[model samples]
Target: MSSQSRKKWTGYAITSAIIISLMIITIGIYSFEEENLKNIITKNQVEIQEIITKSISKNISSELELITFELALLAESGQLQDDLGTKESNQLISQTFDRLNSISPTAQILALDKDFKVLSQASKIHNSFVGATVKGLPDLIDSEENKTKSESKILSINTSLFDEPEIAITFPIVNKETNISNGLLLVTLPSSEFFKRHGNIYDVESQFLMVMDENNVLLIHPNMENVGKNFFDDEIQHDISYNSALNEYITHVLEGNLSTVIVTLEDNIGERINSAIPVTVNGKNEFVFGVVTPTQSINQEIDEIIFLTKIQTVFLLMSTIAVLLVFMLKRSQSFKKEKLTVIGQLSSNIAHDIRNPLGTIKNAGVIIEKENNSQNKIISREINRINLSVRRISHQIEEVLNYVRTTPMILKQHSISQTIQEAVDTLDVPPDIKINIPNNDVSIRIDHEKMLIVFVNIVLNAIQSIGKNEGNVTISIRETFSNVTIEFENSGPNIPAKDLKHIFDTLFTTKLEGTGLGLSSCKNIIEQHKGTIHVVTNPVMFSIKLPNEHSNTE
Candidate 1:
């Protein structure tokens, strides 16, 4: 392939590679950021769930101990030695019950007979419990001595008067004088009451509090209907157990172990993190208190961080691309300018070396043609052709030298009409080619010597393009407020559109004898004078615009 074609394809490949590389880098960054954000959010959620679980369990445990403290104090005070089923004893016990009930209305204080039958009860829900039997109680009298060391023993009880599961504490009652057991005192309270009170006391929102018995039966929940339900026996919605891995994790929770796990649920609640903690009853790990809350709250701050990170990433990428583009563009221009400088230096050296030798050769050819006699007619004719060839080479070398010349412009106010006429006088004009210039004088800022070179090249090119045919070269000057435009239009055969586009490119030409630098040199000269030159091919014309001398506007 040609050098030009190779350069074009190489540029295309480099551009494509840069674009693909940028895309890959952007996608890789996005994926890495997304995964990192997810990991951070998941870790934060686990920590929050564990913290909430511990806080809730500690609060509930302390509250339950307060009730235990009250009961223990009463039992150790020696105030319950009266006979059973007596009116006076009932009145005395009723007064104590009223005092305890005033402190915590949710609690029901009762006196029980030896047969585990309730004798007198003071409660908010049940009006009377004169002779009701309590079910789901262990035979505490059998191991009375072993359990009696402590005033209160925790147990679960279900009675006809209760709505859901209840936590019952049993203590043996003794006479202060004889030290003998007379009856048992029990304090029963709904497990739901503790959960509800916890919600009101604390400011935890969107959290579901639950308490379950050792048998895996749910004793308390935010939802009232869920109370007294067995998690293992009842059907649950969106249970994580469908997945074996999740079920294994849940197994730890059911075994009364402190565990935090993520679970999905229906009803717009979406995903949640569950934290369960074990509570001891009857000196055994027999209850689990859990807090269930949505994961959104845990990740709310993380979401904002991720959003800002993505925006910053995009902004940084765009800024980097813009900076890279600007750097590349400036570098390309610098490289081109450096190349042109080197070519100019080299051309000046070569032109100086070749011009002297060519001048000597031309003189020799001229002497041979002038001194040859009629007998050496063939020799003289050949010498004439040699001189012509030498002249052609000199002209070609001169064109190259002109193309590389980098001279600073010497600005002066000059008459446009006079400059055009002087350029025309220097050109080898044919009589058949009619040339016309405006008589009016228009002043413009220009380098007069360089302007002469520009007009001469354009006029010569026009004449040569017309060949041996009759053509008119008309010069029309159009002056605007800020610019003076001179157009050289010729009636020559039009140049091809494809060729016109590159008419001023270095080393580009359509003529066989052309050095391809004539028009290019003209363009350089015009641009040095802070002017512009362009061409149109319909009738083969060149237009030049220079800044008006009297105009201050740019």
Candidate 2:
């Protein structure tokens, strides 16, 4: 070989080496940035969740204070004066009960004799105890000194009911004029109302709040179906906290200190987060209000932010590596061809790697379709959906490789309606499922292949959700001068509100057989094409939106 040719070849080899080295470095940086972003987002989310939980606790405490004050004022009113006789005293008692009932939905006023037997009841009727003696009135009830001087003592007592776990505020009605006691005026409030009122003030979702009494009995449940059921009933196990945590909380609050505790409980379904707050009434600590929200709710938003941050970081690192590769290529003369060849090889490998899985999925579907039995029919349908997902994933990989292997290209214009139609056509949906698309064509600038993958994956998801039920899938497309918007909707059981934010996250699928990568990949592809995807789900409907911007034609 000539000296010049040899020199050129040597230069080319060095340049190729440098380009490959840059690519390797860029991939490493992408990985690092992804991890760092995840960490930061996770930390921030933890802090935010803590703030929200503490705010909820403080709000509950404030509301309890208000209730206590109202009860105190009602007890001090002069209507319980002894000189008023039975007629005036009864009127006073009736009027007081009416006011209490109006102010507190859960309030109950009880008039008890010196021995704590039932006398008159106000508010809701309680036939179980209308004439029954109070067998479990606490020692504080009988210890009032004014009972010796008259019939009752004006002593404030905080105790729980024997039949149920309710905290009552009992004060003796003593006439100031006679300086003598009459009967005990008991104002009973259920722990459920305490939590409910607090939840109302915060507008918290029902599932996110719960109240358990000191006995660990579920007095207040967001799901009204569980109300009045004991927390330790057959459905739930209470060993998580037992009674120690509740005791600690009550003791601290009774000493005028605020405390917070977190415990985990295993229910029929799964584990849940339980936050307990001790509520002190009238200088006595007898009840604890708890708020239990699922850990999934706290972690979901964080995961999304982390996922997006990781994607952005990966892109930035890739860009940096691309710049370095270009610099190496431009500096050498003979290495350009070799570098181009290497890029082509990498792109081919990525495509091949993606296509292999897709082929397997397709083969699985073909096999499933030949099966005859009903059970086999169900299995075949699921396998076919899996096949479609694999194909969708391969398409996404191809789009990414295409971008990596070439310079920027002009966006192609296509009919949005037609694109969605093609996507729906590709899905192996059940025979009972129906799809509706508008007749009018809406055009938008997008990478046709990439957009098709996004549309197909999303639509397939909707169809699968419809399953064997007689259900409908609706696709609506709208276009503006700069952007095109498409909405795919379906009828299905509502995705729990708590799980909505996590549906797109990696490894977060609700399906038993799902790998949890399809939606995450879809999100990556949509963002790569400078578009957005969102989901809205309710009991009767589930919808997805894809909005894309038109590239400038200039």
Candidate 3:
């Protein structure tokens, strides 16, 4: 491979490596930052949900306490101490329970006599608890009879028709004068109304509110189908392992702990961020309140951060590559300038030294030819040969100097036909060779002196390629809308395909006596005039295109 091609591939490899490294670094940074951002967002979300849950729990506890206080006051006023399960006593308790339900919508309220048999029960939905004895009372009844305080309790009932669980708050009905217990008031608040009313209090719609009893049973859920169900039930959770883990977490929350975790579910709700907080009444754990949110919602802010970071990384990568390209180009220009300066100095020194010796040799040959005696034609012919050799050497030296010359263009408008004629006049045409040119006069912009050198070199190259004194050299000038083209065709031997491609390359030649710089110098001069020059093989023709007057100015 050439040095130039090797350098090109090397540059590409380095650029590709740089791009890949930048991408890897950017991705690494994004991954690290994304993890930290998710943690921060999840932590902040948990804290915010905790605050909301605590507030709702506090409000509900206070409201239930107030109701119990009102019921205790009724007992103290002797309204609940009438004949046990009597018509008048049932009427009074029923009237008071109806008033309470109208205001707060209690699910069920039962007034039980001293034997724990229900006297009057007021329920929004169920109808069988009015006269039946309450079963869960003995487990929850206070052993200390003098205790005048109301207490809240949770219970799970086996109902054949209803799927709802119950949490009832009980207060003893006592006589104020005797300081004795008379009956008990049990109030069961509906989990649905309780959860629905307070769940929507916060403005966060992405999260769903849930309530669970102390037994890990779901008292309220966003999906009503799961209400009053245990967290470990297969109907509620299909994944056995996940259900076991979730039950463990629920038990932890019911034991009065607060936590957050990620869990998978089967209800089309994939991964979720679950925050469990416990609600308390009378300074004791009553139930657990949980806030469940989808994982995508929790990480939304982090996703946005990653997006912005990626955009910035892309911009930075492009900017860096552009800067590097500009820097490399500037370096290449500096190296080229240094190389050109050395070549110019060397060419000037070599041309100056060789020209003096060549001039002396040519002068000596010419003087010897003049002074030779008439009797010896041999000596005169030898002197003539010496002079010819000197001229060829001088021409080769001049070609070398011209090839190394780096003259800037000094453009002016010149007549194209006139310039061609001038260049043809400078060439030594044999009497046997035919020369042809068009008479049309067209003008174009060019550096006259340089373009003349180009025309002289190309015409001479075509003539020499014929290798005979009897061939034709035809010159034609044609004009186009934007350019003027000059073509030179000679009846010369066809150039080999392999040699034709490199004909205009510096230091390239096919002839034994050729200096090799004539055509290359012609190419350089034509290019300096903001034009192009090329050759064809069949007729050994050269074509030159020069910009017209209007094109040059534009």
Best by lDDT: 3
TM-scores, in order shown? 0.45, 0.42, 0.46
The 10-residue segment of model 3 with minimum total lDDT is 143-152
Backbone clashes (count) for model 2: 2
Clashing pairs in 2: 12-335, 218-231
lDDT of 1 at 431: 91
- Each prediction's number of clashing residue pairs: 0, 2, 0
Candidate 1 regions off by >4 Å? 1-27, 84-105, 135-151, 158-163, 175-180, 199-202, 221-225, 234-256, 263-270, 281-283, 296-313, 317-554
lDDT per residue (tens digit) for residues 406-507 in model 2: 223246777778888898887667778888987777766677766776777677777767778999888777766666667777887778878898987755
Better of 1 and 2 by TM-score: 1
Worst 10 residues of 1 by lDDT: 198-207
Give model 2's TM-score versus the native structure: 0.42
- Model 1, position 28: C-alpha lDDT score: 70
Supply the global lDDT for candidate 1. 0.67
Worst 10 residues of 2 by lDDT: 149-158
Q: What is the C-alpha lDDT of each candidate?
A: 0.67, 0.56, 0.69
